[model samples]
Target: MTTAPAPPSLPAHQQPGAPVPLRAVGPPRLRALDGLRLLAALMVAAYHYGGRDGEISDAWGGSPTHQFPTASQFFAYGCLGVQIFFVISGFVICMSGWGRPLRAFFASRVSRLFPAYWAAVILVTAVFALPWVAYEAVSPTDALTNLTMLQMPLGVDRVLGVCWTLWAEMRFYALFALCVVLPGATRGRVVMFCAGWTLAAVVAEAANNSVLDIVLMPEYAPFFIGGIGFYLIHRYGPRDTTGWAIVAVSWLLGQHYAVTRLWHAADLPNAFSYRSSFGIIAVVTVGHLLVAAVALGKLRWANWRWLTVAGALTYPFYLIHEHLGWVTVHWLHVTLGLPAAATLPLTVTLMLALAWCLYRFIERPLTPRLKRSLMG
Candidate 1:
């Protein structure tokens, strides 16, 4: 999201049976997470626009931008930002549900995700994709499937491709929702859930079924678990040393799994000696460190409140960026004859501005109304 994860923590005064609404739960927002959200969004943008030869040029009548300087491996590695998002989501979800009722947890998640997301979906489908049917011949079935954001696990396609992350987020929510269902049983349920899912992933790998691997998405589960461990440490502090050890192990597994998954995308394993490059390692390392720092209160200054805006823009930017920015890049570079230098930064700026507008006009305004309608 610029994932707009649920706010972390609950006020000490909030009682379990008090009927407090999720949004009304008085947790002081963790502002560092907001800044973290912004950073992850930028990484994904870099992945789409600057990765490899620059996926932007794929739209124009030319090859990837060899001429553009920043359009190098830096951008290519940015796709791992999605992994960072997954981990952050785990932290957000855990923190949001920490002391709240089960239903409140679900409601908070819905309010945070759906308002901005639904707005982005309608805009992208109607304004952009529908107009291209003459060439693309879109299927109504595929179109309808993505609206649920359940498409991937349901074996359907996403209306917006970047929305693939939502599918994973949804899965994480589905699994983590167990953590709240029975109140007293929440942690036990979550531990069992993660273990079962992780085992399923192992069996899928053993069976050598690529499809099954994608279906379970176990590789990403470690990141989510790591996030959970982080919440334990942040909330319980040094008393949760076991949580820290678990998180450390989970991070290692998550990074290893991430490299294997990313290599396939980059079409690696050509020689088999060393599959991943430095960029892959850096993305994994830096993302993990950032979360660790936040959990340990190392980035306490990030809680300054203003950074919330950056965090807020992340989701909309992520949703609209790939397709819209790609189209804009094509138009600017090919039609307007702009160079990559101008086109890339312009695309980023325009998308960022649009993301802010979405937050300002669509997200912030609709959030309360949507919460009342959907959660109330």
Candidate 2:
């Protein structure tokens, strides 16, 4: 007897008049990724406080000596958190955009990112800069740069003093948009684009030695590419084996970075390498391998609901806390004579509490409304 014919493949796009699927089949919720976001936020917070003493002084007003001698240096290396955020964003955005129209993808991104960003810029400039209006004049060029997310190239400071990453992310979005348009917006095209971007990032890292170069180079592309690669593997590969691998690898690399003093050199194997004269190809290859391993080993947990909330708040927290948290910590340390050791936990708690408030009252409410108005 002949077997019944298999069901026909779903159309790439639903017909104009046809009803769309109520529950579309796509990537599953990855709580581990949310947890990773939480971890990255914490790292960045710690990095700002523990490492960048100069920014801390400018934001707050005191200089507290390091009291925790055991792991102070290790904790000081918290700037790498931005790199983690970059990679994670790449993966999530790519996965979300896969199989979707380029216009829809771009619309969704603009809806999610722009509302909070604009609000933050306006809020910060109005509240923080107004009181010192005579002393602090907003430069037209800087204002334009910050508003258009082109401040990094123009050497303009972030509006809130902690919004540099927004520029990097906006640039990545532009590049990805270009990729979608030029290469047909297919899954394979996205993959190819990521691969090419990663290679370019490697070369850029190797060629540029200045701090500006590090901030503006192709080195970041690999992290984003690594993220996209993770998404693809999660989407099509064996869930059980691949998921376990990702969780394990990410944890290990995180731990290694946490404990070691090895600086990331452009010619090195680590993710944040800065030296440029060394072998570029080998370093990039190793960096990519490490990132791939970490992405493969990420693990989802049942207790990640809180982390998911934290992750949602991370962007705003990154914007606010880098300055506010340091200010708070410094005030407490100087005014109350609190030791530096006490500042870490207390500051983290306060930042988290403030971030939660912003997420609940401001960002969450505005985001959906903006999305509906802009994209729906």
- Candidates in order have lDDT scores of 0.71, 0.59
Q: What does candidate 2's lDDT look like per residue over 72-102, in tens digits?
A: 4445555667767876887777767655666
Models, CA RMSD each: 7.2, 7.7
**Alpha-carbon shift of residue 99 in model 2 (angstroms):** 2.3
Query: Which residue ranges in model 2 land beyond 4 Å of their true spot?
Result: 1-24, 57-65, 130-145, 181-185, 202-216, 238-298
After superposition, which runs of candidate 1 have C-alpha atoms over 4 Å from their true positions? Answer: 1-27, 52-55, 129-137, 154-157, 184-200, 207-216, 264-277
- lDDT per residue for candidate 1 within 63-148, as digits (tens), equals 45464444555566778888899889888887776556666667777877887788777766665555642224236687666666
The top-ranked prediction according to lDDT is 1
**In model 2, how many backbone clashes occur?**
16
Least accurate 10 contiguous residues by lDDT in model 2: 13-22
Estimated TM-score per prediction? 0.82, 0.71
